[model samples]
Target: MPYTAEISRVNPSCFLFLIDQSGSMSDLFPEVGCSKAQGLADAVNRLLQTLATRCAKGEEVRDYFDVGVIGYGQNIGPVLQGPLAGRDLVSISEIAFNPAKLETKIRKVPDGAGGLVEQNFQLPIWLDPVHNGGTPMCEALRRAKSLLEGWVVAHPTSYPPTVIHITDGESTDGDPSIDFQKKILAG
Candidate 1:
């Protein structure tokens, strides 16, 4: 049978996000009418919020997940801002309590009359757009492997970590497949 372990405070999981902050990310995404970096930052911030909501229990947010975001460009390290800055992996409760800021955004919605209406809502922001340097994907992957390896050793019985890599272009540093296969996929 497949692994059916429940994700809870005692047996939590991990989410490591690898974001490409290369100069190409500043290019506009025609579909969204915004820079690729902006779109990516929005998506990651929204996902963090959703994860925090999922781990909420009564008055407290449970430590059901350890999260990290690494941005590769001129710098390849943790990119989470506010209280999460300079940290690699943090608990879900820390994410729930430490957003950098909140911004009001407008969205288009369908009205009953078949017309579009504008709606405003607050969105918690954790990461901002960053575009610079080369796409050092291989280095980023290696960094992720190091972090996940330590996490696995600490939480051997927990669910395997999930990595979400978002890149706009190819790696400018080196071949990422080699490191990924030899380091990440080996275990």
Candidate 2:
């Protein structure tokens, strides 16, 4: 039978995000009227919110997953802002309770009828759009490997950690395949 590890507070999993903040990410997407960096940031923020919601149980948020985000560009390291600043990995509950800031946004939505209505809502911002320098993807992967190594050891029975890499350009550093093979696949 295939291994099926249950993800719960007792045996939580992990999700590590590798985001590219290279100069190319600043390029505007004419159709969306936003830069790649901005779009990516928005997507990640939404994903984080979804994950946090999934871990919510009534008034409390459970720690069903540990999340981490690493941005590679002019700098390479943990990118979580506000109370989560400089954190390599944090529990879902931490993310739910801590946001950099809340912004009120307006959007047009269908009002049940044929007409559309403007709605206002608050959005939590944990990461800001950033673009600069080269894409040091290899180094970022190396850092991810280091962070997960200990996690794997500690959570031997938990589900394997998931990594999501988002990039808009090729690596400016050395080839990432070699590093991936040696650092991740080797173990």
Candidate 3:
């Protein structure tokens, strides 16, 4: 099946996270007792960490992926922090090299005897929580499509880029479906 493409350092895949950072995101998420922005930020950061870890071998981190965190709100653009602050797309190795911050967190896990044990883990973050202006999802999608088109051109033989778009299911801008469909057919 075409879905069975081999994933390796030489022929890696890509991940693009399109996060919603609109003012509405500040609204509390009843399930988690936190804002939507917090949830989105946490998800993006964790995904980046996981991807880097997946490419880790011994003490070396390989370039098995290219990742992006695109936040759309007051401004629509790449939202990575630290050394990768302004970059739109970066290799997995680059993300491993540049972390906005490292946070020590306590996690509980089950022991072999079914008892809980506490462990500390150093978590890395590339994007922070931001809840500002209106949701410009249309513009963000347009930008992502353009970026993906370029990526496909560059890595035509590699596994197709995977875009994980996290939004609040609302579009302050007009319906993006019109442009979205036109581009889909034209492409």
- Of 1 and 3, the candidate ahead on TM-score is 1
> Taking the tens digit of each residue's C-alpha lDDT, what string does model 3 give over 39-59?
888888888888888888987
Candidate 3: clashing pairs of residues = none
lDDT of 1 at 143: 95
lDDT, candidate 1, 1-187, per-residue tens = 7777777889999999999999999999898799999999999999999999999989799999999999999999999999889999999999999999999999999998989999999999989999999999998988998999999999988989999999989999888887667755667
Summing lDDT over every window of 10 consecutive residues in candidate 3, give the lowest-scoring window.
1-10
Q: Against the hidden reference, what TM-scores do the models get?
A: 0.93, 0.95, 0.91
Q: Could you tell me the lDDT of residue 24 within candidate 3?
A: 91
After TM-score superposition, what is the CA distance of residue 137 in candidate 2 from its true location, in Å? Answer: 0.3
Colliding pairs, model 1: none
Worst 10 residues of 1 by lDDT: 178-187
What TM-score would candidate 1 get against the native?
0.93
Report residue 37 deviation for candidate 3 (angstroms).
0.6
lDDT of 1 at 13: 97
